[model samples]
Target: MDAKETLSGLPWWVKWIAIPVIALVVFGGLITAVIGFIVGLLFKVLVFAALVGGVIFLVRRFTSASSSSRGDW
Candidate 1:
């Protein structure tokens, strides 16, 4: 009949443990791929942000040094 009725007849381990284990066994590869992709994308984004920040820092440092040398500061 319904899921509750079907699961209720089963043991606790079957309902909680076995079903989840079986589902993971069936879809483990897909789940792992999705997680790996997300992690890789996040890592790439962090690297890009760091590079942009470094460029900005270098530009500001050089501009300040050059302006101070010319008696502007």
Candidate 2:
């Protein structure tokens, strides 16, 4: 039987509310762990980008200042 036909007799709450609640209860820890891991990964990536950018900025500023003082380019 098609899924639509099978679920047609069920109430709306069972399809929307109850099913989602049951799924969350069953997989809440897994879901929480996945989200936490994603957040942590994004935070680490942001930190890495900031540090790299700072290093590049400082290097360019110092290099340009020294080169300009030397009268080259």
Top lDDT prediction, candidate number:
2
Please give the lDDT score at residue 31 for candidate 2.
100
Residues 5-50, model 2: lDDT tens digits:
9889999999999989999999999999999999999999999999
The list of candidate 1 runs beyond 4 A from truth reads none
User: Which regions of candidate 2 are displaced past 4 Å?
Assistant: none
Error of 1 at 62 (Å): 0.6
TM per prediction? 0.89, 0.87
Predicted candidate 1 versus true structure: per-residue lDDT over 17-42, tens digit per residue: 99999999999999999999999999
Query: For model 1, where is the 10-residue window of minimal lDDT?
Result: 64-73
lDDT of 1 at 1: 94
lDDT (CA) for every model shown? Answer: 0.97, 0.97
Give residue 27's lDDT in candidate 1 (0 to 100): 100
| Cα-based RMSD of candidate 1 | 1.5
